[model samples]
Target: MILEEKKKKDEKNEKLQTDLCECYLLLNMWISSELLSICVPCLLKAASKKEESEDTRKEVEMALLALCNLRFIKIEQELYLNEIKEIIQHHQEYHNLTRLAYQSAWRFLVSRLWDDNSLEKVIVVEQHFAREAARELEELSKSVDWKKNKKGGERKEKEEMITTLRWMQTLSFFFGNCYLWNEEYVELFSSIVGVLRASRDNYREISEKCIYPFEEASGRRVVKIGSLWQSGAVDVALEEIHKSAKDDEIAAKILKFFMNVSRRLKEKKKDEIEEMKRKELKRKIFEKMEEEGYEDVVTSFHKTFDFLSNKYFFDDALSLDIFDYLVNV
Candidate 1:
């Protein structure tokens, strides 16, 4: 009886291994309608690391490879897109599993935008990818700290920004065609614009216009911020700033983006008395903030923006030398 049970268990293991092998083969050779019905379920099961063990990592890796290639398959169903989003957003073991999810996302994206042989459809199917790219980049921007780092933390902050910048520059290419498909492409531009304005390096000259989102999102936010100074329009960004404060690094990126925007406008419009004019502008902004239900945050943002924009305005140092004063006297 023991030997019989052992034999049955061996057979079951053999069957699972065979199915996993077949899943890879189907993924590579092309999953037919018949094979897809069988392969996808098995692959998804194998791809999961509920145990998250090193022993099971190989299975997860293979499953991800299968999914990466299978992302080549055209899945038009809304349900499938949501599933992919959940996988990409899954945070349980994101550090280990996200690499595959990210790769699969890229593959899923490029496959749709791949333009080599087929007759073009009137409406492109690029919304899912553009939205995902935008969301991911937005998350990064919100997560990064724009505050003055201490000596030891400066390198870490720069590394984080550079990594996010690289991702934005690469994904912006894939998001280009999404403009015609859906407005999700606009979200991509908004997110990337936030990064570009905050980044120390210039990516525009590198990627060119192929990666540029649009004038309305990039230039407006970095320069003027169309309606951000208004009471009604400030809520969305104020909320983002509040959330950033709750994170590991106390990010000030969203606020910095707006501050820079405000500074640029002030520079362009400074034609009259400096101090009185600056006080009026600051008063108006504070009143708008007070009316916008941001009492807790308003004070902090107000002080930070004031300090950054007027770094030299408080200087009391005189440049006159004693010898020069004697000569003049």
Candidate 2:
């Protein structure tokens, strides 16, 4: 009946997907500029194919591997770059493919970003990646295997977590370089704070991986009542500051977060309700920093890094004046 016919059709599709993967791998051994240019469009089509079955997933991975092996200059046009960005931005693809395949595709896309210094491209890619990374972060926090993997449980789950951390570093790079809109910051901030509070042993990893974006968001007017200060983002960050005080980088990032939060306190010309909200947020953050002994932490870094000097050798000192005018605000 119809069930038997559908099964036969699935079998045939699986076989064709497997054969195409084999052919793509074989062709990768003899990659050339002209051959790659001709093959890349088709490869992109395959790599972005919606994940319907295990066979289709493998075919997409193979196509990505083939694309990775090929020369970038041969197919670095807007069409191909957009195709690759679309692949990276597709949140469902993260769940469908193995960690290896997903990592390879992302690395390939980043390689292109580093080579091109176009601000427009960087901004566009950052927005897309930020949304996807936020979704992945929320998903990771809820995953059962992620909880087990934290306790040295499963190899595959551990690798997946590592991949997620690396992606966070990539996000930090984006936030450090470009400015994201308010909506993007709200979503990313909510997810990052949730993950940090939920984390157990990997606290430093979470702080180190996410500090830049947190810093970026704190510098902006991200004072949405429920998502920002009210959600305990500043509290979790201060708690981490005490927990990670021994690590200078994480501590410095936490101080920068406070500095940025304070900088927003100087904003003017807001409506009555908005001004009241900002005042309350500033009061809570300053109070928490005092309770957590942040002055000792900031003074410690200043003494070590010589933040008092007018002329310092490292530009990192310039960024971490710790007590400087919090921002342009």
Candidate 3:
């Protein structure tokens, strides 16, 4: 009887489901924090609806993306533990919802980590939240089909693995800086490294989002002992991506990764041994690029008219992602 009732409920709401909103528009437009303050609550209320039906679920998903887009503004308040719990319990509404949870966590945590008082607050709940995320991630990674469509009304569209990995990468940055890096679930880090290493086509995002955040989070030592890039997996992926990628988006991500790494090495201090190692790695990368005939990747990146005008020269419709990269890269 319960199963039938659940099915009927799901069926009734399925048709009311809406498509994911163009949250990217928030990225492409000029908006102020004051204006965002007005819109954020509406999105959150939509995200916080009581029902787990498809329509409500999509609303939550869209709101989360919109929140991530406006991440520049300091979050006015911390989310309740119950709401954070629902983010991990996203499987009840949809599959990719768990990933959206990671993004929300990233956006929320990052806003606070830079400030003294807010960082104090993060330290208080840091271990508890990290452990909860690890447990949920352990369950989610069990059947990670990056290409498969989500269940129910989302069957037509494949899972948004790229965005999900970006979120995880941001989470990794937070974890890298927190006590969790030194003392929490080692297995969870291993799983993330494994999945990221296995990725092929979307490796550009991995390089920019995943590896870069890990670098930012760690101070003296970049990645921990079992860190993904330390395993040489990131280098291998970059070689493959540089060799085969033709799309402008992929090129942009790759170029941005290279740009960022060069800048980090130049500005940061490191121990003698790690310094030698990084220089050697950089030399090898350039050598390989020359061999593969992608020596002109950056030159080509600069030459791309749309990106040049939109991002570099005009900087009008610039994205936050690109802004962050250019500042650090």
Q: By lDDT, who's the top model here?
A: 2
Once fitted onto the true fold, the runs of candidate 3 whose alpha carbons sit more than 4 angstroms away are 1-33, 78-98, 115-117, 120-129, 132-157, 172-182, 200-210, 217-329
Global lDDT of each model? 0.43, 0.57, 0.46
Best by TM-score: 2
Q: Estimate each model's TM-score.
A: 0.36, 0.63, 0.48
Error of 3 at 296 (Å): 24
Model 1: per-residue lDDT, tens digit, 162-260? 446445444543433323334444555565556554442333222222223332232332222333333122334444445433221122333333434
lDDT for each residue of candidate 2 in 199-246, tens digit (9 for 90 to 100): 545434654566655755565453343355665677677677666644
Error of 3 at 294 (Å): 22
Cα RMSDs, all models: 16.7, 9.0, 10.8
List model 3 lDDT by residue over 1-329, tens digit each: 22232246445332122222224325544455544444444455556565747766666666666655543445455333345445545534455454554456445545455432445334334434445455555555455554443446533322445444645655654643454333343444444555555443344344334343333333323334224345443354355445533444444444544444544545543688777765665566556445655545443443353554444333233233432233121
- Candidate 2 vs candidate 3: the TM-score winner is 2
Candidate scoring better on lDDT of 1 and 2: 2
TM-score of 1: 0.36
